[model samples]
Target: MALMITDECINCDVCEPECPNGAISQGDETYVIDPALCTECVGHYETSQCVEVCPVDCIVKDPSHDESEDDLRAKFERIAGN
Candidate 1:
């Protein structure tokens, strides 16, 4: 499943670089995760890197972009051009 940054994000700028898929960005208000580019770090790491680095625990699953493990892997492969 894709992840999202909640309003609680403090713009700590910690999670953005940790995203393997380069899905996280600085939005108008806070960091936002691009669902199309997000793969929950399936192909890069065992867990979501952004979540692991986030200090406020504001990153959470994006319900509107729910996807299974296989789907996430596929996304990773596709986005990575592998």
Candidate 2:
């Protein structure tokens, strides 16, 4: 599944740079994760960097964009131009 930054985000600015897929960005209020670009770091790291660095633990699996590990890997490959 993709990840999402909830309203609980503290805007600490830590998660943005940690996203390997460039999926996290500063939204109008809180940081937002683009489901289209999010791969949960499947092809990059063992864990989601943004989630690891998030201070508030606001990042969570996006139930609305639920995907399997294979799906995430494919998405990551696409993003990486593989």
Q: Using alpha carbons, what is the TM-score of model 1?
A: 0.97
- Lowest summed lDDT window (length 10), candidate 2: 13-22
List model 1 lDDT by residue over 1-82, tens digit each.
Answer: 7999999999999998898778999999999999999998999999998989888999999999989999999988889888
Of candidate 1, the 10-residue stretch with the lowest lDDT total is: 14-23
Which parts of model 2 have CA positions greater than 4 angstroms off? none
| Model 2 Cα lDDT, one tens digit per residue, 1-82 | 9999999998999988988788988999999999999999998899999989987889999999989999999998888999
Per-model TM-score on C-alpha atoms: 0.97, 0.97
**Cα error of candidate 1 at position 56, Å:** 0.6
Q: What TM-score does prediction 2 earn?
A: 0.97
The residue pairs that clash in candidate 2, if any, are none
Clashes per candidate (backbone, < 3 Å): 0, 0
